[model samples]
Target: MSDTAPTSVVDQVLAAVSELLPEIAASAAERDRTRSLPRYVLDLLSSAGAFSVTVPTTHGGPGGGAAVAFEVTRLLATADPNVAQIPQSHFVYLRLAELAGSASLLDELFGAVLTGERVANAQSERTGRTVTDQTTRMRLVDGATVVDGRKFYCTGSLTADWIAVLGRDEDDVEQVGFVRAGTSGLTIVDDWTGMGQRTTASGTITFEGVRVDPSHVVPRQRAVTGPHGYGAFAQGLHAAIDVGIARGALTEAAAFVRSSTRPWFEADVERAEQDPLLVQRFGELEVDVRAAESALVVAGAAVDAIASAPPSRVDDVAREASLQVAAAKVLGDRAALAVTSALFELGSTRSSDDGLNLHRHWRNARTHTLHDPVRWKLQHLGRWSVAGTPPPRGPQF
Candidate 1:
């Protein structure tokens, strides 16, 4: 879809998704109404090998790179934004396994991924004085690791098989530990009340002396500072989600204009599609979606390239990837908000329809894009343009 010839795995995955889209779309409204993702959809995705896309081929998986991930995310978001978003953190966990420097642990996690196990991220505590501050603690107890804290925005954990808890050790170093979902003393609260992306299940999780095996723990310092493509991978995934939302908005807008919308009485046009102003608006939205799509392709390719680069070139390649991804994120965020908001202007009263629930697009786009401030993204690009400075080492960069 982005002018690249997809590998066999990518092609097969896309074909499977195409076949499943009708069912996915048909249930999207109902799922949104309930503010929950259905198990059947996840089962279908597993059957299609969606979770195995990023697993290495040698690990008995597809090994689709970042570009394939972008395409898959875009397509899924077009069907259901919530469903599309469930894998964002899963991929991040997969990347973490690669960087964890524990071969046995990595192999175990990779095997779990191939077998359709989902990993949910438990980070972002509300009690923190600042975003970077963490009250979550990981400590040694009886020669075993234990994690204790309350985490909000624990996306996808409601149905996840494992939870990746981010915390700080006694030394104040950030660390991640994996725990089984039903582990004792661990509680996943379904209390997220966000106005958008309702089905993401981005709720709260409490870990009270939850045991974490030593092998399951990975220090996050290197992953945060090292020249891996994690940041770019994250940014690309978000950009693809926004792009998909914009595309979905545009698709719904065109359909409404063709069948349900009426032209302005004074315009002398028989149909809404025949109205020059409406046509101009559609054209503008199409251009925005196309621009966002192009940016995503560029950013995704940069991420894939940087991820495959040698260690000597990792820092430079990751820097370039960050710049590209920042640009793509800005464009995608803007396009999603613009397209979703503009959909209401195509006709009167349709925005108020309960059956359509069209407002979810804008809400989801607004909420998800706020994950990282776009102003900083622009500032990062500006600084790079003028000073040749790369983005700093951080997860959100």
Candidate 2:
């Protein structure tokens, strides 16, 4: 039940990422401008075996943990948040498959991942009463399991090799079905118009009686009674994205001020970097970014601890992990928003040029942080602080 991939493969992927990131970063602006899928980067990572790193050591993968994936995600986010966020549900599916405890499901899904196949999420629907609510149905038509419904915010669906959909079966039990990318009656639309993460292609997906191989439909999200990290792990990865956005924005801001920005006229400085006010602001922003970064790593470690906690202490450890992740997410959200907005302010009018696309950072952060409301994150933190209550368990925590 490890999303903690084998350690060795994880290390190799991380090492390769060090070389790929500069290339990834160099193309981000253009990709943002065109709203192009960061297919180049996605292919690069897949080729480097990033997706395969999470395959269980028992499956012949170099063993590692979710902490490694978080680090890799943080690095990817620094270069391109859209690409960084896309594969979230892919790994989440791996977690789900593990929870199902089905040997066949694990081999099929993990083998696909190892073969560089990508799974896009088709889980959310606008018509649902709540985010977790699912109305999509998987029905037995004569013999085939057919899916029929509409999904919104189907992130990564466009570029994905496979689609993982959450639906309900005849007994009103929730289930997840996997469909190949080009399955009949499936329609993927490129209609997302959000101000940020545009390349994510998180738009409309229509499944009209699309057939899923019966073997590909796993019983969804098995209930785990013990202290577990089912939700904390997902939230921690989110924090990693925010960390990347904050750091990336700050990095770009520094470069802009040093080479492209003008000095404040009142300061009579030759360069913006020499202006004491701008320097002070940059230092403060760096401190915020680094603090958020630290929180992200701590959150990852806390979540990792859950994987090994003995049965007696697992509950408390899991609760602590959730709390730590909530803190990391709060810091990440604040840093991403504050620093991204500050990037433009410090860089002046020139920074707003369309060609530079510096604004995409703020736009991406604003759009993404809105996806999972930050208010709930604070509410959990406050509940834990004042009432000595553990955060309620779920993806929201």
Q: lDDT per residue, candidate 2, 1-397, as tens digits?
A: 9898665657678899878989999988898888888877888899987766667787766555668778888898999999888877677666766666467767777778888888888988888678888888999987788999999889888889888888999998888887889999999998888889988857688999999877778776563334667788778888889999999999999999999999989989898899999999999999999999999889888988987899889899999999998899899999999999999899999999978889999999998888677788889889889998888877566
> Clashing residue pairs, candidate 2?
4-65, 4-66, 5-64, 6-62, 6-63, 6-64, 7-63, 7-64
lDDT leader? 1
lDDT of each: 0.85, 0.84
Best by TM-score: 1
- For model 1, residues 292-357, the per-residue Cα lDDT tens digits are 999999998998887678888888998988899899999999999998889888755765587788
How good is model 1 by TM-score? Answer: 0.96
Give the residue spans of candidate 1 off by over 4 A: 1-7, 310-312
**Which 10 successive residues of model 1 have the least lDDT summed?**
346-355
lDDT assessment of candidate 1: 0.85
Per-prediction tally of clashes: 0, 8
